[model samples]
Target: MTVTAEREPAQVATLDPAAIAREASPEALSGTSRTPALLIEHLSKRFVVGRKRKPVTAVHHVSIRIERGEIYGILGANGSGKSTLIRLVSTLLTLDEGRVAVFGHDIEREEMRVKRLINRVSVDAAFFKKLSPWENLVYAARLYGLEAGPAQREAVRILSRLGIKESRMSRPVEQMSRGMQQKVAIARALLTSPALLLLDEPTTGLDPRSKLDVQTFIEELRADHDATIVLTTHDLDEAERLCDRIALLNDGRVVAEGTAAELKTQVVRDHGGAATLENVFMTYTGRSLDEDVEEESDDAE
Candidate 1:
């Protein structure tokens, strides 16, 4: 794989405000890419944890083609390479083999251009803990070349839509609950109007109601904006509800790929089981959906 970026990962990592600030452009914000939203071919990424230990193959040779405006989900157990795949596409991790393209622009050949077209939200988002939600979002908007006055107004609209009160906008993010902070992260990613949004375990820690709020907003974004979302989550119901198609990953490789209903029908026909995503997971991965969720850690997911 070619080195597509000259900068360090921190500059273009998830929620990369500094990188967005440096590379923002009017065309980037226009969201007018005519090609498929995302294309990946034989992608692979491995991590060298120690000299004595062999490399960990985090993402195997995975290939996927996502059409414009589709909501795609990468569903897997913990450490199943869900987040690793998202990181690879978001330009946070380098590829060991294969290629990724966003809107016909090759990620390696046109790194900066790709950066402008995409933004990422991870399970644990970072922020200026001391800064208010409005402050943090406006700062991100400025990085994306959006005008501050309009940016602030848009931020309010977004947070309010997410069920955050206007009164909470001025308080330090450190004071907010985990679910509220996650909502703020979603708002920040949307502030730039990214054409391709990468969400890694977006609802991992939220309560049921908060999860519902985020899921509803996600559906609305796909319906109302020029947004193609790639979501990585283990929530079976969430994937069945939000994703247009789902890919189940196991041990860093795709075990099954199809719409939720398709997968369920497949399992029932081939494996003799209930027609549900939960059954689909069990059929393919040889384990229950909730098995060992806490034992194996997903690296920096």
Candidate 2:
């Protein structure tokens, strides 16, 4: 199980469901006099690694802001701090440096409130081998303080919408495909109607059809549920297809960021490479991990 830190810093907000729903109001998604759904400023995290026990920087001073109803993608190779960054936002890891705010509430100060407003779906969907999809989701919903009857009905609705047959939801989750299991995981996370959904490699390790199904569901969630998503992915095409904007991370820092077209144009015009996400990834991350950070010039078109 993914463990999140559980300590209050005093003066935390209420965990009331209505108060959390106000955070996801239509005006909030419209961005009219509203703060970002997620805001990170100079965020950093380090881990003590190696026999020498020296601290290795897992995430440097990375910063990002995501508006409500936007699918913001974080792209990086393995160990580039993509998952580390997600953990920091989801409260799995405490920040060694910097600040993170969800819907204008400080993560460290208002952790319970933040937890109520967001839910995470990791790449691997964990489930009891003997439990069916409906049973698993109902159990998870009970943990989130939902009545089992309502949660189970909603689970069937969501699973059906995600292309899982209602009949199959009765079968053991262990008997399902990885993609099917992922769909169930997503359904479980949506039980509380999280305003900010943190998707940590949600489509990883799925077969092509399952990958497409999950991708379509992700798109539908943004359109139908008004959920602000922070998605981390290794698939370039998936990012381009599903993300409104993307940040390319390298060596624990954002090396470049922009819309897919903007990034492609930037690489082609500036670096004279083929206009592809592959080129953009290579141009920004191919350098030494210890290289100086790439600076962004605000005047650029």
Report lDDT (CA) for all predictions: 0.80, 0.79
Model 1's alpha-carbon lDDT is 0.80
Q: Please provide TM-scores, in order, for all candidate models, with all chains considered together.
A: 0.86, 0.85
Residue range with the least summed lDDT across 10 consecutive positions in model 2: 1-10
lDDT of 2 at 251: 89
lDDT of 1 at 23: 44
Cα lDDT tens digits for candidate 2, 91-190: 8899999999987878998888788788899988998979998888888888777899888888888888888888898889899888899999999888
Q: What value does the lDDT take at residue 75 in candidate 2?
A: 87
Candidate 1 has a TM-score of: 0.86
**Candidate 1: tens digits of C-alpha lDDT, residues 27-65:** 333345334568899999999888788899998999887
Structure candidate 2, residue pairs in collision: none
